[model samples]
Target: MGIFDFLKTKKVNDETFNSSQFQNEILAFALWKFNETNDYYKVEKELWGIQDFDLSEKQIKIIIEKLKVFNEKKN
Candidate 1:
């Protein structure tokens, strides 16, 4: 099995950890890429496929907030 194959296992209540986990992983990957590129718009477009162009400090904060929310929601 793959390293992350454990994600498919049944939890205590048999509930599946679905897309939320996957989204959190993707967001983490995007964050790592953002650190490298430092181009929010380009990283959003290339990594997350978000068609946003607001490259302001507020936008960066929003992205970070999204990552935090997704991470917190992850089991």
Candidate 2:
């Protein structure tokens, strides 16, 4: 890892990635990732992206609960 790498950033388009949209997109992507392989480890990376995703408290609870259900079903 280089110090300069910390300076790098990815920009979201002005029209595409506002707060609510970012959350929705991350959730959507995580759901798709989960569906793709049914692997929690892989899905977790997407969930980390979702920490940057702006979400309401209610939304967080709902999403986490859904994830729990998914894992329970998988096990």
Candidate 3:
């Protein structure tokens, strides 16, 4: 088997991945990516994408607020 073939294999079923227990993994990714970018406009624009995402509006707001804080803390 090719090295990349392992990535094609399902590490976890969809149901488990959607569970709250697996949720922090998703949040951590967004936070990490958000911090990686330097522009505030880019961050705000990217934040809007979560409006149509599967997560609730409250969750989206929380992430945006958290990201805003990330910039604030750096100054």
Error of 3 at 11 (Å): 20
- Poorest 10 consecutive residues by lDDT, candidate 2: 51-60
Total clashes, candidate 1?
Answer: 0
Order of candidate numbers by lDDT, starting with the best: 2, 3, 1
Encode model 1's per-residue lDDT on 7-60: one tens digit a residue.
Answer: 553321212213466446646766687668765566556543433222334444
Query: Worst 10-residue stretch by lDDT in candidate 3?
Result: 48-57
TM-score of model 2 (CA atoms): 0.41
**Model 2 clashing residue pairs (backbone):** none
The per-prediction tally of clashing pairs is: 0, 0, 0
Q: How far off is residue 42 in model 1, in Å?
A: 1.4
Estimate, for each residue in 7-73, the C-alpha lDDT of model 3 and write its tens digit.
5534444575457765565546556667688654565556455432444445555556756676578
Q: List the residue pairs that clash in candidate 3.
A: none
TM-scores of the models, in the given order? 0.38, 0.41, 0.38
- Cα lDDT for residue 10, model 3? 40
Give candidate 3's whole-model lDDT: 0.56
